[model samples]
Structure formats: C-alpha cells, structure tokens
Target: MKRRIAREKAVQILFQLDVAEVQLPDAIDMVMEDSTGESTEFLLSLVHGTLENLPAIDAEIQKYLRNWKLDRIANVDRSVLRLAFYELMFDEATPDRVVLNEAVELAKLFSDEQSYKFINGVLSAYLQAGATTTES
Candidate 1:
C-alpha cells in the first residue's frame, strides 16, 4: 500500500505539472500540505526527478511506444509510464520488476482495463530492451 500511495501522489503531481508548471519543491510542499503519508517523499522525488529528465524519459518511452507519443497517451497512462520508466531507467535502488508491477497496479487503479495490459506490455518491453545495457 505504500507504493500505491506513492503512485497516486505521483500521478496527481504529474497531472498538476501540466497546468501549473511550478518547481518541484513548491509543488511538493503544496501536495504535502493536504496529504499525510510515509511515501510522500518517495513520490515527490520520483515525480520531480522524472519531470526534470522528461525529455530523456519520454525519448525512452517513445523508443518502445511503437506509434504512441507521450502527448497522445492518456494523462493517467502517461503519468504511470513516466514514473515507472524513470525508476526503471534511472533509480538503481529500485528493481525493474517492482517498477513494472507498481506501474501496472497504478494503471489498474487510474486507467481503463486495457490500460493495465498496455502498461504491462510497454514496461515489459522496456525492461527487456534495457536489461542488456544496465551495468547494475
């Protein structure tokens, strides 16, 4: 449930980014002001870091997205991909399986039924494609 909370908060923060374009610290303070949880920092870091490196992250996602662009994807699905893809690509402390699983769960909660399968497939492909390049 810790990851679930983190994922939910991350989604909200990512969604907020589209409208406000505020800095992460300010955004984090705003988000945390109303919410209480153990996973808040983790979510904030994930959301902020991912936003910082979104160009690279979206490039990676685009590499595996076939025909889908980040802008073309639904907000919830895009947020899930951004968080999971960031962790999978950049966060050495988090395991690939954990990122993929958490992303699928987030998709299930925030997106349509088909989104769960789509997210799983995209992330699975991402892991498979990335596995060879990872030194860790």
Candidate 2:
C-alpha cells in the first residue's frame, strides 16, 4: 500500500480502537480485509507503535494543547495526532516534515475544517520544542 493510504488506514484503525474498543490484532485484521497486495506491515507498525506509546504520545499532545483538554479534542483529530506524533517521536527514517504534512492532510480528510489548523498548530509546537529528538 502507498504510505499515504497506509497512514489513512492507520488513522481509521486507531479511531476504531478508540471508539469501538477493538482489540489490536482484531482491528488490524478487520482493516486488512479490504486491502490486498498492499503491504500491511507499515500500517500494523503505526497502529501497534502508536498504541504501545499512547501514554507518552498523549502526554506530549497535552503539553501542546494549550487550554483544550485531550478528551475534548475530536476523536479523529486525536487519532491523527497520535499517529503522526508516533512517527515524529519514533520513526527517525521519515523526516518530521513528512510526518507533519501527512498528519495535517489526514486531519483535513478525516476531521472537520478547523481541525487541520489545530492539528498543525499542536504538531508544530511539538516539533519546535524538540520533544522527541532526544528520545532514547
């Protein structure tokens, strides 16, 4: 699968996990059903890695959220942030800009009009703070 498609799928699976409380493996299987000849490995990595590091990711997002609480953020927007933040913090191979752009794009597609701005602002803040560069 194209990385964009995989990323979008990752967001969807993440959203499903949050709202439906689906098991990780089951969620992966469910999303993969419609996909064929598309490498699921990347998608699975994003889903599992984001879930594995959710607490830390949420904490990072909270720091940049300003006045808004985490739970008050839209589920789709939160999922997009979580996935992008995972890439920013852990996937060193992909540049931060790519992750941020993809995340904003995903936000545009999956979330409300104003959500992209909020997502972009929060991510830009996270990057500017260099919060993930020293992750070890």
Candidate 3:
C-alpha cells in the first residue's frame, strides 16, 4: 500500500511554503519531524528535491499549462504538480503512473473539484509526451 499519510503531510508542507512563505528547508524539517512512517525519507526527499528543482519543475508546468502562467495556478495545484513532476522527472524509484495518480488524489483533497481534472489532464499530457525537458 501507499504511504498516503506521509504524502499528504508533504503536500501540506508544500502548501505552507507558498501561503505561509515558510522557507522550504525549514518546512521540510518541520514536516519530516511530524510525519511518521517508514516512508519519511522518501517523502522528505520528494519535498527537498522538488524545492531544489522548482524552477525547472515550474518551467515544465508552464510548458503544459497552455494559457496559464505558473503564478496563476492555484497554490494547491502548483504544489501538487511540483511534487508529481519531481517524482516523474527525477525519482526513478517511483513509477510515473503512481506519481500522476497520487498527485491527482492529493489535488482532489486540497483543491476544488476542477483541480482533479486539470491535474489529470496536464500530467496525462506530460506523460504521453514522455516528459522531455530542454533543461539540464
């Protein structure tokens, strides 16, 4: 089974980073400490690595977002995209489908009903196109 709770906690921490303007590393420390699970390390890795690669991740998001700018995306949807994109792009340990599915689920939990379909469409298009990036 998935460590859904840990993923949920990471999603919350990511949300805090945007709304609360909390430093990413500090948010990771707080979230990692509070989140209990065998998957804590994986969750922490996702948060930190995604934060580290946020610029590139956002670039990818922008490529797929069509008319919307990155900043225009809801904070919850943006964070969910960052997490899922990080996993899909960098974390070979996580399957692409799992990353996309978990992101959709998280978006549904944190965002409006429209968020689920939006995230699903973006991630699906991303996957279908093989997630090629011009960035290093």
The candidate scoring highest on TM-score is 2
Model 1: lDDT of residue 69? 79
Model 2: lDDT equals 0.89
Per-model TM-score on C-alpha atoms: 0.83, 0.94, 0.85
- The residue-by-residue lDDT of candidate 1 on 1-136, one tens digit each, is 2666877788767866765678767766776776754446677678877887888888888888878877888877888888888888778887788788888888988899999999999988987775512332
Off by over 4 Å in 1: 19-30, 37-39, 131-136
Give Cα-based local distance difference scores for all models. Answer: 0.78, 0.89, 0.81
Candidate ranking (lDDT, best to worst): 2, 3, 1
lDDT of each residue in 1-136, candidate 2, tens digit only? 9899999999999999998967877877787888867778888888888988999889888999989999999999999999998998888878999999999999989888799999999999998897755472
Candidate 2 TM-score, C-alpha based: 0.94
Tally clashes: model 2: 2
Please tell me which predicted candidate would have the highest lDDT against the true structure. 2
lDDT (10s digit) by residue, model 3, range 1-136? 1467767877888888988978877876776674455556666776788888988888888888877888998988988888888888877777888888898899889898899999999899899998733343
lDDT of 1: 0.78
In model 3, the clashing pairs are none
